[model samples]
Target: MRYLTDRKRAEGLGASKAGTEHHWYMNVSGVGLTLLIPFFVFILGTSLGAPYEEVVATLSQPFPAVIVGLTIAAGMLHFRRGAQMMIEDYWGGMTRKVMLWTVICLSYLVIAAGLYAIVRIAI
Candidate 1:
């Protein structure tokens, strides 16, 4: 028979296995968003309130297009993770699963739509 302390026995069973991973992901994405948002805002501000042709021309430039794409992708992924965490915390059972999947799909859809718009504009 093996004798184990209670703490040892419970070491890995008391929490979600991916909690640390989730937390790290959220922190990293938060930092990335912090850095990217400023540039994104600047790019957006420059394009905002302009005529259609001017907006398209500004976004068509490689730098602005790439920045917008990155911002969209990162922002959506970050939003997905954060929303999942919130849903998991406040929900349970099948409802939790449904909400999680719905949020995931919605985030992806938004990302795809945003990127597609950017591509069309850039091209």
Candidate 2:
């Protein structure tokens, strides 16, 4: 029983389980964005040089629209998580909680809006 108690105390001072999970998520998102950025840049560049209808047509593709929507959602979620961590680390009092919640809510709203726009274009 004493050994278990001591182990728990030691674990408490170390990196949290949630912190590990967050790190994993952030790393995964970073890798995804690394691959996605080039594709997005190429697509945007081509679309910009094209005419207006061409732009619409390009975005109207189901696959590209879905990819864009997923990228937006993932990026927003990653940002929210990161910002929440920063707030928790640097801020104190009620302001930290408020800012964290605000960031979460705004992230969800942005993701929803992006999905709506993607669906509208795809369909």
Candidate 3:
């Protein structure tokens, strides 16, 4: 017979085998959003009271367009994951399932609309 400690036996029996991976993903995305937010805000803040054509021109440039696109993608993904974690922690059963689905769909919808707007501006 093989010998094993209780801790060892319980190591892989957590709620989900992918929990650690999700944790690391959340941490990394958190860091990414942290760094990107200031740059994005600066870019956006500068463009804020400009004329419509000027604002469009500013965002059409490659640098601003790329930064805004990355920020939108990262922000949405981070939001979705964070919301999922919160709902899972504070909810149970059907509520958790329906809430998770709603959050995921809403995040994707927002991301898609943001990307479409950015593309239209850039092009």
Candidates in order have lDDT scores of 0.89, 0.80, 0.89
TM-score: which is higher, 2 or 3? Answer: 3
Candidate 2: residue 104 lDDT (0-100) = 94
- Estimate the TM-score for candidate 1: 0.84
Report the C-alpha lDDT of model 3 over 1-123, residue by residue, as the tens digit. 759975456556667766666777889999998988898999999999999999999999998888898899989998999899899899999999999999999999988998999999987
Once fitted onto the true fold, the runs of candidate 1 whose alpha carbons sit more than 4 angstroms away are 1-14
* Model 3 C-alpha RMSD to native: 4.3
Report residue 117 deviation for candidate 3 (angstroms): 0.8
Give candidate 1's error at residue 103 in angstroms.
Answer: 0.6
* RMSD of model 2 against the true structure: 4.8
Give the per-residue lDDT digits (tens) of candidate 2, residues 12-98.
Answer: 354554655677689999899777777777766787879878887998987677667778888898899888888989998999989
Clashes of each: 0, 0, 0
Q: Residue 59 deviation, candidate 1, in Å?
A: 0.6
The 10-residue segment of model 1 with minimum total lDDT is 6-15
